[model samples]
Target: MTSAAFDTSIEETVEALTGPWRQPRQMLHGQTYDSHASIHDDATAQKLGFKGGTIEGPTHFSQFAPLCERLWGKAWFETGCISAHYRAAAFEGEEVQAIVEKPADGGNYATIRMMKRDGTEVLRGSASIGIDAPASALDIRLTELKPLSDAVILRDIKLGMTTASQTVRMDFDQNMGELYPFSLEQKLKVITEPSPYYAPESAGSSPWGRAIIPMEMLSVLFQHGSKKDRLPVKGPSVGLFADQEIRLLRGPLFVGEDYRLDRQVVAMSGSKRTESLWVRTEVFDNSNAPVATMLLNLATLKESYASYDQEYAALPRS
Candidate 1:
């Protein structure tokens, strides 16, 4: 609620963490007319009933990095996985805290929650190491997903459609193109959690032998690359991340490493107000070894598009 709630002494404690964190919410945009023009802007988001531009859900994942490190140590950066469901929107300068519950078995898995200082839950999820661990928040949701029975905003996208394979790399000093639109140096200046591991000098000496990409930056590396226009999910409609999961299969992906990416539409579903497309993206090393996988749930708000009502009424029922 107040800045006083974020006491550094309390944050150093074992069970709790207090963060007066802020994110530059409006800066990131999707590759669409609506996403670039309105969805991520304050004035437009206000019209959609949100406080302001919603902070990208992946940005909050950075907040949990310290907690994960505390629980599982550096191995987390290599093999850790976080699966989360965005419960509510977070605006810039909104102080938030990540609370961690130690696993009963003293294992690598932990229950985690992010809440505003005023006690409003922003997201809920599970964090763990290893790919074979029990079902996490996103894992369970993946199983329960129902097929899209009615034509919604995403009706044009077919399940199993895949994005063309693309090559991607992250460099501590290079400027990433449109997908990221910023350099690592610029990102560090405003990053919510800054650590030496993200620096070239210090990180180069670590076991990874190079500046390891931060978990938050991994989203940029995986998403910000050249892609073939294939899936035709109507235009001028705004979409936001509803849920996300990142799993490191054989890494702490390093900066400046060449990695190949492939993504596929795995499922489609919708609610009264939104339609969603679930995609699974895989990353591979130069040797063709598996590196990491990202599961993203992109939800498009129905009200954002003017043709929703007429379009839905014309579709044949499943």
Candidate 2:
């Protein structure tokens, strides 16, 4: 028997769907660090005051998939965008649920939030369709982003500089080395939303005619495919994803397809405690066709790294 990809139950007044509570799977981070020792590593995280390696922020977006489909149907897959601000970290084995609120007038966007079973808010964001989505969580955050007043680690990254493109693909059975670096089967085992479509044999049942990559994994795809060594920012400074936005152009990106990734530094903004760089990455298929785009706000903690006052003082004044 073929199981449906998602729950199609639609409410009469405003559509609503509650996802199954899921625990954080550490597979993505494991792939991200190549099993290296880092903050994402369990022991490192414990030393930093976290219970364990925190799950990547994008993982929570999967809970909104079924909800977005119910509200906008297939269009959600074609042009849908989910912009979010991760408020708190969720440790491994902790269950969380996503709740989506649709406007009474049946608009193109909806308010969404993910919370732990105990009602602790994990993330808050919006899901919308089309190019003109209402100010999403990341959108609002971008507007509020201010230029750094002092010289910082990210001060050297210039806006509008495009990075070298790289080829990226996701295979259901193969462990994508460096790029994702994990097999699809591994991800499916602990994915927040388990669907038949995520499996190789049942992937044909999907609307995309094959296994469609989950929205969350797109972050991994972009990161590993982009040019990380060329960024001018000096590290050893702890950084975190402050906000993120993902949008597909043609439709759901399928698994096992090669896509070219090009990233551009769009903006640099910061706050009193942190400095950030906003990068927009565009994904193109083998045919040079545009597939999707992702915007990431990577924030560096100023307190974690040593102060640069001496370095700034030595530099010639602007």
Candidate 3:
């Protein structure tokens, strides 16, 4: 395009979001939490060192992307990248605050700071405004970066397969200008307009309530491996939540509740030439109660298919 077109798009971006927008409500309250447990679930708040299960760290950050889309438009997730520090822990049913400190946005570049309700810091994030084409990015169209050939699905996993020896604090569910109360109630009220798995009730919430953690965000809590590393049998990890077979082991994760996450590599199989990895993830609350679990599969696409360099360009100074 010409200089005029560039100027026009720039202007549009500045005036992109009219009225007011919110940081995701999901961040407001965390699920019940507990890191220490016997089998992932069926423990007590005493052993886990808390009253309930804590929210999955990865699940906490995923909320930002949607907020970015709301603030900057759909293009944000295209070239967007995010990373953060887990400041505090959220439990199954407690409400926290999620806030955004505006960025110094430039074409192809933007920065944002987010925090939680307990007066804690969360993430220092930036986006490269579509700088390098990512692996899933297509030259001619928007193609999902496929790192595997078929979706990997596993079953009957042992609990506690996924264990993290780390701790982080988080916040969310800012007062919503005092329009709402209890982030869970407020959040459950609203659903992604085009959600794939569930929907909102006329009350604008899901009776299902909140569980251990949303399965889609689980991929981040593990060692996803380097974008450059390729496994002959496993291949590199580039997959989406094709489907989930989630089970509620115990109760739901509520605010003030600590949580422990466990993962079981249920199974892995596909032609060596065909890349695929499947696993089952399980989560339990501090009481050692099975909060929720799921079976998710990721399909891999040949690495030779796309650009790896640009995809890592915006990955937050690793």
Candidate 4:
């Protein structure tokens, strides 16, 4: 592409795409782990000071697809990436809008954000297309992380720890297990954008000629087997998605297709209120070809852990 043509594509005068207000559903109300209700449970959320069961952060990812597709066309589905830091949680029935700004610098990346009807920012980050679409929000944030300090819940978690490859699939009606109990068929009913590409019956009309999993469901699919991979984080405590990035290398991951997942602890950091475990999961097709990647910062609440302070005090000082 010529510099002039690229400049014309992302002129400063280009208007940002804003999506319609949509209410994302809370599918995790029944989510359980460590023999107890998860943070998504209403009671569990209230105890932690949240209004009610909060919608999953990734659920908002669906809202960005149409807007991004408008900006980058088909490339948005194949190599699209959304890197966001969740600023606040949104509950069911709360309307939210997604906005994607055209890059003023004529790059393949655009700044993106979501806002609740009450003007509260839900999440903010970047949306980019292609492998070379400049540095992502998480890519820049990862470099600015402060070292893990006074670790408790995530003290034992070391960077570079990789889990064994696990084979997984996301069939339309198959429930995604404990972490995500809902299936693709169930999600489509409430998904922010209804795509014929994602429906089995109309999939033949899609460019891929098969039903493709929605980008948001890719979050459920990647973490579907997380419980069985058991990393060393002391996690009877509740955790939330602090920040996340989903990038498709060879995507529009198909429905009912078998894939392999490999996860690694890429980094770890902590704040006064939460300890974070930054994990990166790589998805591969049956032929062992790379398909997609997800980077998640699971921030475990300090107050939710019973013996955080006691255990941290026991660790030997450096």
Among the numbered candidates, top TM-score falls to 4
Question: lDDT by residue for model 2 over 85-198, one digit each (tens)?
Answer: 878888878898887887557788788888998888998888898877677777777777777666578767788988888888877777756535587668788777766667
Off by over 4 Å in 2: 1-3, 7-16, 28-36, 47-49, 178-181, 227-229, 306-318
lDDT against the true structure, per candidate, is 0.76, 0.75, 0.33, 0.87
lDDT of 1 at 153: 77
TM-score quality measure for candidate 3: 0.33
lDDT tens per residue, model 4, 153-186: 9877788998888999999999998788788999
User: Where is model 4 more than 4 Å wrong at Cα?
Assistant: 1-13
TM-score, model 1 to reference: 0.89
Name the weakest run of 10 consecutive residues (lDDT summed) in model 3: 1-10
Task: Give the clashing pairs for model 2.
Answer: none
Q: Candidate 1 overall Cα lDDT vs. reference?
A: 0.76
Clashes of each: 0, 0, 69, 0
How high is the lDDT of residue 156 in model 4?
72
Among these predictions, the greatest lDDT belongs to: 4
> What TM-score does each of the candidates earn?
0.89, 0.87, 0.33, 0.94
